[model samples]
Target: MGEPAPLAVAYDEGAVSPAEIAVGVAGLAPVAFVLPHSPHVRKLRPVLSRLGRVVQLTGRPERDAVLLRRLAPAGVLTFSESLLRVTAGLARTLGLPHHTPEVAEVLTDKYRQRERLAAAGVDTVRCRPVPDVAAWEAALSAVGLPAVVKPVHGQGSRGTFAVHDRADADRVRSRLFDGPEDTWVVEELLRGRPSGPFGDYVSVETATGPDGTEVLAVTGKHPLTPPFRETGQFWPAALPHEDREAVSDLAVRAVTALGVTTGVCHTEVKLTPGGPRIIEVNGRLGGHLNELSRRACGVDLVRVAALLALGAPPPPAPAPPGRVYFQFNGLAPVRPGRLRALTGGDEIRRLEGITGHRPYVRPGDDLPGGVGSVFMDLLTGDAPDHPAMVELLDRALPLLRYEFTDGATTWVESPRRAC
Candidate 1:
């Protein structure tokens, strides 16, 4: 009889597309996708089916565990934050290797993450979880003004605020909390140079296997927009020898402390005046960095993640000093409006150093918070140098136009003007 088909499983939260991860996993073995019923997944079913089996996720631990066992997967993979716990639970149930559910909890919840890091002697900001308005006031007072208040389980900078005083605190509190059901954290803000090559923070992308953990690349982030939204990121962040060592060392400690034994870890660190401090650790490849690594340095993180899941060694990633630089610009609208239309696609796509162009908003789509579709992820590009890359991005902004409408009126937006 022919050997049984190699089997692997993936949790699709329909958050970011898992195409890269799924494709890589399929290269080694057939993959099965699990999702909690979404039209998005259903529409992509045909394309995903070509990669592997697609299954409905029932949201019941025991029932899902039975389905996973029936599939007899050799490993499970997930990149969605909400699905981390379920993925780990399934792995545990199947007697397969995975990060424990407890560790997944620590990675997903900010408060728990800080507590665990502190216990491991890692320097993290002073933080407290406040569940009510009264507690929010107290936590802000205790942590001091200019503190950051963010959802304990938040992502993408949503509901994260920098409260500088009582007025700011009260304003954010009224808008942020609905009831005691809300869990938030207030912490002292770390100060860093406003302008720098690495901006104020950096993320270390590491891959771990049987031998040990490898710090594959350090990515430099652009300065965040107000309220802490990441606007852009560049790969192979140039760091001084000492800074690089310190950041990489802290990344290792943070991941080891959390008991992440396999797969990829994305660790963010603030370059504070006191040195690097752990911000948070993610149990998946850094968003965009995965593709950036492949485009810029020839390191395919998705492939590495898949190989690790299947208990195989990934190919060695070539060290930097390569020919191309990789980057992406997340175009977040500064005001909310209905997207009427987009113009200049052909011109923008033809720009030098421009690899691709994608618009996240559709004509007539409602744009909220002045930010257009926050879910809109743009493109990945390869340029010859930093300046040329920036120029390329700048040139595209002028070529394209966003025609939008509010309830009262309509206007044409040249993103170039905003930038």
Candidate 2:
């Protein structure tokens, strides 16, 4: 814990990382977060300052095997589950407690998760693998309308679209072309009242040891409603005590069944007529929510993971009645046009109920790819002033508007050319 140990892996050193928190927690050296592929850690491709070392690998198993041996480190961690599968041997050779390749596959695949959970008699939404139009339709017919359709191995907020009817299904899927496994799953849609307080996702955060997983925290997902898209999350779920326990129980059972040894996860569930129903699981830290958990809960997930991985005791979970929320951009168009102004920024910031925000879009610049990137985001904080927050959000949203650069006259000047 004095100074960082010599760690190895690949990641951008310039960026803020959980590695910082990991070092802070374990009293160990910063991990050498390695990137073996272009898209893996390309953006965060800079590593320096005795914090860790980067081992770039050529796109070949032999080269990867050779490279890992040269840059041996005490530990390895990754967001990509595929890495575990791709380099299990290298990790073992390096004496790292990395996730086994099979463990990664089981956690990511929706089809396998459902089967395992159901076999164990765990409460979960009925799920089946879906590969194409024929399988999609057959699964839908079996699962029924209002079913959820999503990529079998996809992450949060990615390739997930709900089909209310045939049309809604067609609208999203019309452009999809087969690539990769390009298959999906159909799950029995568990209905929750749109306005119920139990609407948020309660991600069961935990760690594992020889006996089993220890429940560290229950992070509540903030954004409600679904085509199953998320806008934010917060900790200390608003769910009643009874409801919270039920979710936690299921989370522990699911993680144990899936063989997740450590790391945070964005385990999904729906509070339904029967009770909490697990939608799926992932073997990584919760994205936006994990950061909030660090600040609010005072429990560094990376440190807990490292402890569990190193077979050490996890530090005590921080209990700060701290609430965190993802700063969500109000519903706006996907295309770029002139925005009038930001009326809500100041007002929203000033709102008494607000916590923190990271607005991804600004008034003038274009939106990035409509929307992208989020795996398990369950960290939107408290909104006690629901009525007031809504009123404030409404006022703040439209306070900004959009128009052409040339002004009112220019919009008309378009093809008319008469300025």
Best by lDDT: 1
lDDT of 1 by residue, 1-419 (tens): 95454555555542336577565555577767776666666777777777667777788888988888888877777776767788889888887767788888888888989888888897767898997777876787678878888888856676778888888877878876663338899888877645443368888888877777888878877666666777667766656789888999999899989888877888988888878988788888766666677677666677787778766653554677454465555454667778788887788777766777777677878877632116433655766666565666676667777777877988885653112
Q: After superposition, how far is residue 266 of candidate 1 from its true place, in Å?
A: 0.9
Once superposed on the true structure, which residue ranges of model 1 sit more than 4 Å away at CA?
Answer: 2-7, 13-18, 179-181, 313-317, 370-377, 414-419
Q: How do all models score by TM-score?
A: 0.91, 0.78
Against the hidden true structure, what lDDT does model 2 obtain? 0.56
* Model 2 agreement with the true structure over 1-419: per-residue lDDT tens digits: 54445445334321136455445444655555556565536655553334445566676777776777765555655545445455444555566775566777777778887888887777656676777766766787787778776777666455666678889767756633354647778777777534343344567776665545667777655454245555444556667789878988888888877777655555776766667878777776555444665566565566665555555654555564633333333333333234434343454456565554444444465333222232111112234443433444344434333332323331211100000
- Model 2: how far residue 44 lies from native, Å: 2.8
C-alpha local distance difference test of each model: 0.72, 0.56
